[model samples]
Target: MVFFFLSGKFDQLQHAEPLSAIKTAFNQYFFNISKSDDERINTTRSSILETAGDCIRVLTACFPGLEKIIGSHCTNPTKVGPKETQHRFEYAFRSMVKAIATPSNPVVLFLDDLHWADAYSLHLLTVLATDAYSLHLLTVLATDREIKNFLFIGCLR
Candidate 1:
């Protein structure tokens, strides 16, 4: 049996490599997988914080593998190409999500603050939601009601 434990109570036998600037930059504002331990400890109860922190750790594990794709921007620092950069980020983002998913374990991913999500995040959400329809994954979304023009707020008008 393959078990993917996303619990902080359990020590990770696998060690993750340090994050690159590109990977950290993307996750910083959107999902905050780079949130500090103090931040998590203060925001929630010990139990929840531990589990949440573990979730972040699990997600960020992919950053090490994605270093090449992300670090490419530095290698080509002369050109103006946010489009190509964003596409790579989106691909990396999805790959990170895939690392956390397990068909038998039924993992639930919660995405917060969608009301102000960047283009890459919104695109990734769309991709995940579509793929989730035929998989064991589940997504719980949160959005502020103030965003009257929010794409999912069609009836609020």
Candidate 2:
């Protein structure tokens, strides 16, 4: 899920004169760039790295940090094995719980190319739907095929 504080809080800042306010907003909300040591050059490389880190954090929360397992065990069954998939599902449950418990900020999770997800991922999505209402969270799952499973279909009901 993605959270947006009221737009009004940011709109004025974004449109302020001299663009200093906008720059400040970007710096504070997005990144903690060095203020004293360097010229303020907008670096796309740094921005990309920062965003990737944020994405990793969200994913780690979602699956209780299973990316490491996937990386470590792509070839070694003893290391990652089928249990890694189950751990990912558990992580999703934890993510939902954490988001719901936070209470203040809305959480947004984006699951892209869900068609590539394994059975455990689908199971996690099912569990998420059940606990979804308790959290101020939004999950976006993108897939090429129509998902017709009962767990998903029932969520819309």
- Kindly list the per-residue Cα lDDT of model 1 for residues 3-91, writing each as its tens digit: 22221110112112222222333333224322435543233223222333323322334444322222222231233377765554445
List TM-scores for all candidates, in order: 0.41, 0.36
- What TM-score does candidate 1 get on C-alpha atoms? 0.41
Candidate that scores best on lDDT:
1
After superposition, the stretches of candidate 1 with alpha carbons farther than 4 Å from their true spots are 1-80, 132-134, 146-157
lDDT tens readout by residue for model 2, 60-92: 333322332222222212344566645643553
Clashes of each: 0, 5
Clash pairs, candidate 2, are 1-107, 1-108, 1-109, 2-108, 62-91
Task: Give the per-residue Cα lDDT of candidate 1 at 82.
Answer: 79
Model 1: which ten-residue window has the lowest total lDDT? Answer: 6-15
